[model samples]
Target: MESPPSVEIISSSFIKPKFISEEANKPVYLSPWDLAMMSTHYIQKGLLYALPKTQDFSITAFLDDLKHSLSDTLTHFYPLAARLSTVKQQNPPSFTMFIDPNNSPGARFIHSSVNLTIAGILTPTDVPITVQSFFDHHKAISHDGTKLSLLSVQVTELIDGIFIGCSVNHMVADGSSFWHFFNSWSEVFRSGTITRPPVTKRWVPPGPDPIITLPFASGDEVIERPNYPLGLRVRIFHFSSDSLAKLKAKVNSECNTSKISTLQALAALVWRCMTRARRLLPEQETTCGMAADNRKRLSPPLPETYFGTSLHSVKATTTAGKLLHHSNAWAAWRLHQSVVNHDDKVVQEFVNSWLEKPLVYTMSRYFDASCVHIGSSPRFDMYGNKFNLGNGLAVLSGYANKFDGKVTVYPGRESGGSMDLEICMLSKNMKAFESDEEFMSVVTY
Candidate 1:
């Protein structure tokens, strides 16, 4: 049998911000929402771009320019270069993030190379597990920010392409912020400036005590390495614009309502198909948890450039029998209601509950044979990150934070409202899901 691919480390170093300010060095208290993700894994994702075809194209020059732009980018996104510090001395430990200019704490940058082709990485029926090697901090969780770099980047030089992998502490940023930093880096790389600067001021709930204290006295008490299930397989399923429109039309027609959105219809289809593929008991309960972006949902919406985690998980649930027996529109309506109901009031209420008793997210929270958790919005501009090499051929999720029943949605490279669902599930279930006719019907890839 052929051995899996391997990555040879060419170089590894810390890339500090080009400039720092005393204000940027001040400790910024983590909000309750940020504290909630302390136990989760770092957000790991990367973009693959075909190498430019030009006699002047020089890999060495390209990499040097990329690193220089990243340094300049960090000047604006300095918080990413900071460390997560725990105030263990406090009665109940408090967390704060700050950059120590004197110590020169910086984002970890790794340069690596792999003897593989772009097709070898993207043509497989399943996402290559070897892709995990393209990222740093595979075993590190968000809380490890105390000792680990809050942000780590690995640029892997492929035979005909380049894969830029990024791992950001989940407690420090969400999908929105992740993409913001990525886009900013690309902008700086190509144009030497950004259109909109990131808002570094972290959001705090309006109350007597803005900073919510953790129940634990030390980071050790809260840090946990979740044991994900074994024998899992991940595959990307593509849904074209026409396919999405057809799905939305079918569900809305069946329900005689136009309220179900394309996302709702798509979620409903996955929820029902996975339930059938699992072959669960008829009466067993099934749940679909969707990560709702609360930036706009909150009253007096935060800036689009807000640089921190701002997400809430909303769930729609029903018995497996009911889910399978119901019309596609019925399931879509359930998901639609769950998402639309998460308004400002709900967001604030969840914050209040977290303040009363902080609860860090664990993989087990959503790990269940009967549960599906969907994250990463399809609305994110996955294909627009050019960085002078042109649009990405594909966007990939790393092995970190992966568990059975986890589904991450990304906009297709083809754009025009198309979407790609990166689904992770047990090997057995994946085999069944791949053979599922209804699910495969809309899948373009």
Candidate 2:
């Protein structure tokens, strides 16, 4: 086995917004949806780009440009450059995210270099464990927002490429907002401006009270620091557009339903395959949860630029026997129904229930060996984030919030309907899944 690359940190500093206004300094109230994510891990993701061919390429100049663009970008997305404040002395403990211009709580900017090539990191079947080092705040959860920076960016220079890793508090932003900020940063880097300015005003669901407070007396009571599991393997599986279309066609034809989407079909396929690989008892129950964006599901749908955490986990469950005995179309139909049923009414009910009693998303609440939870979306324009460098070679997730059944979906670098599944599972189950003929047949990796 090859030795892991050594990463040396050259500098660690905070990048504040270039400018701030009175309106920008106002405290942003946390909604029930935001509070629910307090215990979850930060969203750690990054882009890898090959180095430019010019001989005059200067690392110092490139780093300077990145910092300046980030500072300018934070002017619009000011919340990211701020900190989460908690007041335990209040009646119910007031929790709000505030930007203190005097304190200037800026986002952490880290510059580092690795002694390895990009191929050394990407060519392997399993993502190198060291890749997690490319990100910051590995031990910090969203609840730590009271003191920690809400967002952290680490730029690690490679032998012939660079990796820009970003870690954002999950309570402050979901995958949509994470990518929105990333795309905006890249736009600022290339043109010194953004085409679609972010809508920083958070959306509040209709309820008796717009601001919801948690039942806890202090933020520390809700903080959870769970040790990451061991003996888990992570691998990326590529499914080409043709393969995806064929899978979708097969399932739709079998069920005589044209409403099953490619993503639904793919999720069903993974759920069934993982169940089979686990060799669970026939009578045992299995669940598949997919993160659904609620922006469009509301009555007065939120704007595309509505920037905050708006994701709800829509789940489908069935007996292991039924999932395996039934055809792929059957499973796909189940998943399709779960997503379809999560409409405006269901979204409202969820928000109301959450408002009545706010609950933080601890690891135990959502993860299990018998369940598979899918996060992120393939619809994100990942490859389009070209910060003067050419298009990205790959997109990767970090070690935070990952477990045996976590699966993250990303658009393939080629980007014509191709999809990549970053799957994490127990070593034994991963071995079985790799050997499964049906699953391997469609995997282009």
Candidate 3:
């Protein structure tokens, strides 16, 4: 493997929101959903942009514009400038947690650069870039509870373009809220105005506090990152529109249903292929934990711009051999059914079912060796954001999802039906997976 590139940080400062409502200046409690992620890793979402190639580039001006616009953008996203705090009521016990807006510390704004260029990071041939480079190296964001700011922004200037990255507290929001903030940032920077005013109304699930009862790890408990069955690897694959159409057709025809969705087909294909590559025994059970957006599904639909988490994490299970040896359509049908069944009521039930357990929903407990965790989704229109700085945003590298046996799906760079699939797994499994004939048939690596 090649050595990681070097990056330099020139300056750093906190960017405060230009305006704050009187109500937003107080402490905001974490809903049951927010409590579920208290002990987990923060979600780091990175955007790689190929800025409009300019013969003359002004670093000073660029930094000023970015910082100024970001400050303005924060006006509508005041919670991001807030800090996390734990409340204590007694000795052997705990108290409800809340976001202390009164103690809000402005978000960190970093201006950095790397020796490399956009072309060097994204190749015309194989994998453009590994997200670990952004998450692990040149790290400017910290998620530790010690950090006062719940959000951080790092803008790296490459030779030809720029890389815009944001680190956000998962406790404050999920993937939906994460992107919503970014889209708003881009809009403000490009046009000096926010097209979508952020909605801060958090979804308070109908449940008691300390959402999940599963036993959370004690402060001393240590869970090492997964690196077994040979070291791990992360790779990105592009699936063209034609390929998705083919899978959709294959699934629809075999299942005798015309409503089979693209996501269902893709999920089934990846799950089956991964299980086959692992060569699990017939009786060995494998599972998939997927994140579902429960926004519109709620009885009183969540506002399109509701700026909080509405993710209802759900799972599906079956024996390894059954998933692989069974008809592709069968697996696809199962996946489709699983999602279809997880309606609004099921979303609430998912939360209610977990209210009795300790907060075991930490990242360490999210996925096991036998299960694959699928987060991120094609539904997020990532490329739609016009990062006014570029020669038309060329490619979106991706967010950093460090865990093994994980997959994140983003909108394809090409047509509407396409997809950019990022798969992270053991190195041995990746090699076996890359060689899998069925998987490679429709994928462009």
Per-model lDDT: 0.87, 0.87, 0.71
Clashing pairs in 2: none
Candidate 2 contains a number of clashing pairs equal to 0
Candidate 3 lDDT for residue 317: 88
Q: Output the number of the lDDT-best candidate.
A: 2
RMSD of 1: 1.6
- Clashes per model (N, Cα, C within 3 A): 0, 0, 9
Residue 246 error for model 1, in Å? 0.4
TM-score of each: 0.96, 0.97, 0.89
- Give the Cα RMSD of candidate 3: 3.3
Can you give the lDDT of residue 386 in candidate 2? 90
Local accuracy of candidate 1 as per-residue lDDT tens digits, 170-227: 9889999999999899889989999989998889998786555666766666667877
